[model samples]
Target: MTASQDTIGQICKLLEPFNSTGKVLTPDTEISTDLNIDSVAVMDFVMEVEDHFDIEIPLNVVSETHSINDLAMVVDARTKKA
Candidate 1:
């Protein structure tokens, strides 16, 4: 599915525990500071995103992502790669 059709808002909602507010977050949003999401929470977030997208997000890519937008871009790119 396309990124626009993928419902980032829903993903962000699942990430609410991470302090996301359903915003179009930027790459520099600071996943920890802006979202208050910890390392474990980030893992959970990655799992949720993977399930939602029906894809496997690489650990390295997940580690590289620092924001919602960054994650989205990674997902998009990975989806394309797949």
Candidate 2:
């Protein structure tokens, strides 16, 4: 799989715990709306993602991020190899 795809998949795995509703996670799944993750929980989930990816996601980025795809794209951009 491509790097973006891999990042998306990894994010899906990381997001499983926050998915209290047991929803099927996809790149398009809205973290807050679909999974019903609250603001505090989203921040916690962001911390987990940061730890797993070893890259810091800025507050601005987090605010802009809605779906898993948005986060994966940010991660892919941050971790891209030159």
Candidate 3:
């Protein structure tokens, strides 16, 4: 798989447990809106992402990120930099 695809898959795995709304997790799934995740939950999820990916995602990027694709892109870029 391409980097973006791989990243998306990994993110999907991490986000699955948070899918309490039973929304279909996809690359375009909006973290807060679609999944009904609050701001605090989003931050918690970001911390999980950091631990799983071994990359520190900046708060600025976290604030700007909305969709799963956006988060995956950040992860993909960070992994590449490593």
List model 2 lDDT by residue over 1-82, tens digit each: 2338899999999999889898898888988889999998999999999899899898788999999999898888887741
Scored against the true structure, residue 43 in model 3 reaches a CA lDDT of: 91
Q: Once model 1 is optimally superposed onto the true structure by TM-score, how far is the C-alpha of residue 14 displaced, in angstroms?
A: 3.1
Q: Alpha-carbon error at 22 in model 3, in Å?
A: 0.6
Candidate 3: tens digits of C-alpha lDDT, residues 1-82: 2337878998999998878988888888889999999898899999999999999998899999889998988898898999
Residues 8-69 of candidate 1: C-alpha lDDT, one tens digit per residue? 55556667666655544544465655766778878887898898778898778788877666
What is candidate 2's local distance difference test score? 0.88
TM-score per model over all chains: 0.69, 0.91, 0.93
Go through the candidates in order and give the C-alpha RMSD of each one to the true structure: 4.0, 2.5, 2.1
Ranking by TM-score: 3, 2, 1
The pairs that clash in candidate 2 are none
